[model samples]
Target: MAKWRGPRAALAVAAGAGVIAGLTLRTAEYPGMLPAGTPDPELGLGLRLVCAAAVLIAATLAYLTFARRQDEPLAMTCLPGLVVTGVVLRHLVVTLPGAARISPAARIVPGAGAWVLLGSGVVMTAAGLAAAFAVRKTA
Candidate 1:
């Protein structure tokens, strides 16, 4: 747990905070954030912001509580936070006003950058959990 408790925990907190900041700066439903020609979906920016905030808070709490517990599972405590942070930050960034200006291809790409970020976040989270699980098993 030492590995997760120290650097990993700090990283998790940073990621969560980043996501929250990103979302506050750029709401998900804003135009020019999604890929070009993407139909205007009826999603609410307020809802996405709320959800992102929830994820950040949950992650922080998990780190402070479960992650700090002596016998707790590192994966169990940190996986959700890492995954949520990655996904949320990705969404916020992809949907930011300037994202489209940087890469128009992102809009044409099937599923767009936000989707890619979400998928990547899931994979990273799974990998982190697996690594933690393996360590526990070995010990």
Candidate 2:
């Protein structure tokens, strides 16, 4: 068993998770958008973070997989990044436009898609947290 395999696998998984998270944001049901109809519900900070994380993770994984293990401390660093990214993503999703942005008459109710987003985000965050903790424990 090679030492690099662990980090390589983790990065690939994180990239896949990132892709799923980005897809969930695509569905309708804008939860916290001010004005209730923010044209593009798909554009959010969480999505950006996950997408960025995914790309960065994948790139890091690719480099690690091919470039040879340069350092002992670099394995699974993306998991911690995933943990932070997932938390930020969920946070942005839960409080999208912020309370002050919405008018008193406007009430945002989550649709089925919104529920899906929330649920997926929670699961993603939980998984990231668990992975991060596990990585720490092992180290």
- Best by lDDT, which number? 1
Worst 10 residues of 1 by lDDT: 108-117
Off by over 4 Å in 1: 1-4, 27-43, 65-74, 77-131
Candidate 2 lDDT, 48-135, residue by residue in tens: 5555565465446545544663322233444544554554455445544443245433443333434443444444344444444554
CA lDDT scores, all candidates in order: 0.47, 0.46
Q: CA lDDT of 122 in candidate 2? A: 43
RMSD (Å) of each candidate, 1 decimal: 7.5, 6.2
Model 2 misplaced regions, further than 4 Å: 1-17, 20-24, 31-50, 69-76, 83-90, 97-101, 104-139
- Model 1: which residue pairs collide? 35-107
User: Per-residue CA lDDT of candidate 1, range 30-118, in tens?
Assistant: 42455555543322476455546545554655455344553234355345545554545644555443454555444423234344335
